[model samples]
Target: MPQTNDPFLEIRPYHDEEVPAAIERLVSDDEFISAILKYRFPKLSGSFRWLFKPLLKQYLRAKWSKIKTVRDVQMNVASYMQSMIKNTSEGFTTSGLEKLDPNQSYLFVSNHRDIAMDPAMVNWCLHTHGFDTVRIAIGDNLLKKPCATELMKLNKSFIVKRSVKGPREMMKALGQLSAYIKHSIDEKQSVWIAQKEGRAKDGNDKTDPAILKMFYVEGRREKIPFAEYIASLRIVPVTISYENDPCDAAKANELYRKQEDGAYEKGEFEDIESIVQGIVGQKRRIHVAFGDVIGNEFETPDALAVEIDRQIYKNYHLFPSNYIAAGEDHASITDTDRVLFDSKISSLPEGVAQIVKSMYAMPTAKKSDFPIKQ
Candidate 1:
């Protein structure tokens, strides 16, 4: 367990010393054991949970016996990630990472797409290189289950309290979050956070200025200049491009429902289901592009957000699907790409198909608006 007097203990990831206790707790937790049974042995899990839970717990205990530190947990996760990539993706590639200094910690603000894969990909790239993996930022909304919280924290994820209500409570949570991020950077630990609160369902990747504002909360409290504070964090805008989104159809359906009904509601565990599908579903190719650190003078959050968006747009990799959706020709577009893109579109309703097409096309559209900086 974490020290009782630690202020950030509630939100921070588990310390190396706390890993053993956490692992033991997880193996013993009924919910966690049941979840494993359901995912791995679905047909038998519902009727035979009593039979499988104990066996699963024993298996997990034996499997995780050597995982005594946080680094051990991350290595285990990395092994699974490698297997998942091999099974679900054609290839994974990265750019601009070679330019980064492994010795320096950075704040990576990336465009959100998949609930979990965005940071996972970033961490994988950094780990494969000489750089240390980043501390991921995940929202509280995704942690309704205690087991989920344990699993995330075990993998170096910190909580962002998005569920906090009331203005005072919200402000307090934001302040603490900002302070924790700054503290991590000061300790030479890099952090990964989305540019906005949610995934860009519409495929339009824009940095919410409010997110930038939240980052400045601690700086403002200390009466520091905004530009200097921004520069100090070494903010790097990262763009993650997928040749095909695993949840594209679901996203399109939700958007279509919202357009017709003016509101859409999620099922109790829909987010969790999406996370699972994203991990296992097919993603043809993925590219992660790390942009230059923001050292320019920007006096306001909005200005900083604009620069971040520009970099994301410029660095975003345009896949064949994007070119096909945008009705543009590219040397990379082939007959196979056309057939695959068409199959995806044909699987959706006409209205939802248009939305999905637009979603894929937005990257191509936005690229023209923000040309690459020479």
Candidate 2:
């Protein structure tokens, strides 16, 4: 943990000066090392841990010896990101990035799809375009393991205390989070948070008004007008579209089971599995669209949420798969697109396949209902 008197020390990412110690902690963490071994050499990790664990630890220590700063860690992550993109994606593209001021730190509220890839793709785009990466907002539920917390914070992520019980505690957590976000913006550091608490597993992206309300918790306490306080944050709505979601089938199955069982329970490590799958799975093609920074005209969180949703829906890049699943005719649709879409659908059971198709079709359906702003 960061040893400091800072109020947000418990939730905020580690500072540059703290990077070396954090790295050392991670290097020394037996669970972290074992996790890596299980991931990279799954078969050998169980039966030959005596032989592989020490070697892996030595390799990690040597590999991270020179990484003394947060930027160095990010640069290393960037290299891996580049390799991942090259191997797992057909192509990556972006729009509306030119409109953002490089020097101004904006609060980027993005549609969540993949647990790990959404903010990562946003960070990659900003990093490659000479803009500073945003401090990501990650829920505490995702940081159940100490290693997970270390990894996330090292990557410029702040914790959102989602599991805090009781109304008063939840409010306090939200207030602290809101203050941290404002403080980050005031310090000219950008932030990226999901529009809601979790990924849109069913593929429908909607901004929850509660999230917007949470943003104003601190502002409300300070007696700041909602609109003016919102404007000050330079809130931007971002849309990320994937031609192929690596976890679509898994997501669909989960959703379907929930529908059948009336509730769903996640395995202890299911989220971790999803994160790894999202990182390594083929995405076909991906597009990230940065939207216009919102103005101060909206008077309430609900209204602000509507506008954010509007931008996300408008800016979402519709792929041929989306159109095909929606049963819509489009000039961009091709024979190969049909074959690939069909193959994905055919691999699942009929019920789950329908859910998967509906998931892909949702963006198209939502976009059609919400027309673009003039």
Candidate 1: give the clashing pairs: none
lDDT of every predicted structure (CA atoms): 0.94, 0.94
Q: Where does candidate 1 stray beyond 4 Å? A: none
Which tens-of-lDDT digit does each residue in 56-100 have in candidate 2? Answer: 878988999999888898999999999999999999999999999
Lowest summed lDDT across 10 adjacent residues in model 2 is found at: 44-53
The sequence of per-residue lDDT tens digits that candidate 1 reaches over residues 250-352 is: 9999999999999999999899889998999999999999999998488999999989999999999999999999999999999999999999999889999
Local error of candidate 2 at residue 240 (angstroms): 0.3
Give the lDDT of residue 197 in candidate 2: 91
Cα deviation in Å at residue 65, candidate 2? 0.8
**Clash statistics: count for each candidate:** 0, 0
